[model samples]
Target: MPVRQLADAVERVAPRDRRVWEGRLPVAGAGGIAVKVSPVRARQLWMVVGMWDRAVRSERLRGRRIRSAAALFGRSVLEVFWDLAQAGELRALEPGPGRERALPTATLRIVRDCLGIMAGLVKPADGAVRLPSVEQPEPKATVRAEVLGEVYRGLVDLAGAGPLERDGTALSYEDRTRLLAMVCVVLDAAPRSGELAALRLGDLTAGERAVGLRRRQQKAPPNRAEEIAALAEVRPSSVRAVLWGRRHQVSEAVYQRIAAARAELEPLPEVEWYALRPGTQVALRRWLAVRERLVEPIQGGRSALWVTLVPTKAGPPGVTLRPQGLTQAFARGMTALNWVMAGQYGWEPMPTRMEQLRRAITVSPVPAEVVGK
Candidate 1:
């Protein structure tokens, strides 16, 4: 019989009989009979066959494997049908109460079972044939604006010098700096956590017009540059400078304390220049100066842009803030903001609340003369 006719016959045969026939018959002239295979089926078949070949060569498959040329040809035909079944191209009657329902469906186990049957038909040149492994599904990405706004608000509250009380407790300076740094970087750079965490002190360049951040792309090809907008209001450069100064301040203090106890130590390195807009520069400089007097200088190389000043028993007092740590901080801040806003406003959408807040800030105070009139 011709190869195409035999393949068609195999496809039409009952499941039990088809298996019996597959074990007895051999395939030939597959190249000439390529016209019989549909494009989609052929593609899936090629993938399955390729996987089987790799498994055999890697010795992943042991014992009897598809080695006969005729059997291999017949195996390809079975593969096409198996691929169809796995892809839900074949329908089965799903027994229901009072009636039978026909639907196209294939479970993961069913697909693997069909693959196992196909594997049995082939004799590998070296090892036995093994079933193909399933590929994992990719995770879906989602963005929640309300949660983002809460995190932003938390940072703003922390950055303010005035005591910020949430639930009758004042926030610490350490919490303020960490939250502020995360908000500033994320708002300005709009980079993923990995890319943000990988940023180095040298990667930032502040020009006369704007600041530029140069870092290797985490999700793209090497050498591709990603442009990030610098919001005039956010003042990311200013935040960066403050973080740098805090680290130096902590390190200097530690050195001084050690000197008093035993011997003198080398002076800490100077903080680098971080350019900012005319309006923001003075405020940031003043903040850093005050921070120097109050906070201890940070210890370590301080090469990483993001570092936590809060002392902890887990490790060193000064440690670099990782991507995961930053994410967690942001989440916690968001949850706190949500709780506060929900209580005061009695449940409103975040966007509406933000709009109201914006309007309140932008509203100019009436003059004394206007009020008197």
Candidate 2:
């Protein structure tokens, strides 16, 4: 369906709130209470609805087609979403050579969210579709202790070897240093890819023995008006008290309790600090020296600790490294290590998963000290 048509369908069913049509989609939350969502979510809702609208042939239903989200309440909207998934429309289509792919867990989730909200709008008690259980992704395979030892040794050897000029290929020495530092950190501290990517120059404090990591908040806290709106629905008495207290004095004890509640609701920092092993610290320092020469300080006086070692279409070298970049670097480094091992030691290729690397470190009897806490 055209975007305009989907927008029209959404507008027809959406509440009178201007924001709902303009930017947000109001979907029912846990108890069928409405929660606002981004326009991207709104698009997903209509995508499923459009499939339904096109499939329905009954003149009465087809003419009125999804006139309201309530039209989807007890309907086969979930089935439609699944059908699309099976057809390789909802997500990538990578069926086996002879067989169709099974419905993905992620598509299952999308169906549940889209249809569930529609159900909630009509039936508060049963707001969403009761979906079949989704299969969880299998955990990364653990590298054997001997294999891990060899892999670590290979990486250390490669890092110390500096840039390779084999096959007349020009490799970035800075990138190799960065990947070594990242692998060392991952083996010792096991920070999430995002945390590692977001590390800044200032995050490495205490002489780089310890690193502080702050995870940016993904969801914004409710604004004052939103809080009041929620209180009106869930805690009417408290809302009333707050409203009354604005014009009149409340007891000191009551005031203190309210203050405590407000403080408890306030967002807390998502910051963490991890102690680095001596080896990990040394790797980081080496990378920092390479980074300092490759990247000059801008007017802001500081930048991301890890940066692109090579130019990209987006820009020249020195752009801040994202989580994807870190993953790619690890993959490339592992591939190079495999080539070296295969040529020299005649060993089979080892697992190159970063998750498995971290897991291997975690499950070892004498695991590398990756965390202080």
Candidate 3:
């Protein structure tokens, strides 16, 4: 839908907002009707916010063994310990009231590894761990799906916030590519990032109409890589799914808009900020925003409360941004944040390497937003 059209619709409904209905989105859609987001959706939205932060922290460190070998592996002390604490928090959230802990196979890998890292005295040369056995299955997969939706919301918010880079600097083409590569590391190392990352351009670009994606580990035993069953198709300028048990398709134009938002993301100094170090909270602080889709930060599973969009075949999503301009200011935020919080929380000051990753394992309730709390 065009911005003007969307805006007009929102305006028409604005006056009718008096404790609207709360429920899940309908499985099927009519040609042109819009519906109020359900209560289940609102909860899911907040859960995603919380999950996004958790995934980011799990990537570069382990829980128990964080300190044993971090200075050696090149990650900072701060990053390592935070991962460990992050893991503990998730494990505790395994079964809770109003909280969830299930995640995809890839997310399972991240959470478990942090525990392994925290357990060992000497660094285990093989960096791996078995997934924790869970009594229930619902939380595991639901959280991951939630994150993909959040990624979409985040992209849209970022686009609207405009470019977020530093000034007087032009990234060499290679530098720009490298920068995006780094920014995605936070996303890639995240819970479902592995599944999303597993997407070979071939996998993403595979089908002629809608691309096909398979839900990998859901029904499979350990070591069984499930066949691709999830399907995504590329329409004229949009992507949709006519096969996921029901109708699911966004406009050709919306897809283009999302793709553009992602392209514009790389130019921001946030690309550099994320690229420079590996901290989930740091990234969240840098990019988390109050937007249409946000319910609460790390609320449960999905990173964004709404959708997840990416680049496609015909034309890369085109965007214009200026993030490089904020480099120093971001660095200062990093430093001040470290100064006030780390030591106060028992973390070592200004950790400088990657292996210093195994510290705390916390599922500390990530508030919905900077303002939401």
Best by TM-score: 2
Which regions in candidate 3 have their CA more than 4 angstroms from the true location? 1-154, 165-191, 205-209, 218-373
lDDT of every predicted structure (CA atoms): 0.39, 0.59, 0.30
TM-score, cand. 1 vs. native: 0.35
Looking at candidate 3, what is the lDDT of residue 166?
41
lDDT, residue 82, candidate 1:
46
RMSD of 1: 24.2
Model 3 C-alpha lDDT per residue in residues 187-289, reported as the tens digit of each score: 3332122232232222211111111222332223211111111112233222112111112255455444434443443221211111112332233223323
The numbered model that scores best in lDDT is: 2
C-alpha lDDT (0 to 100) for residue 279 of candidate 2: 77
lDDT of 1 by residue, 157-204 (tens): 546645446665444555555555544444433545555566554544
For candidate 3, the lDDT comes to 0.30
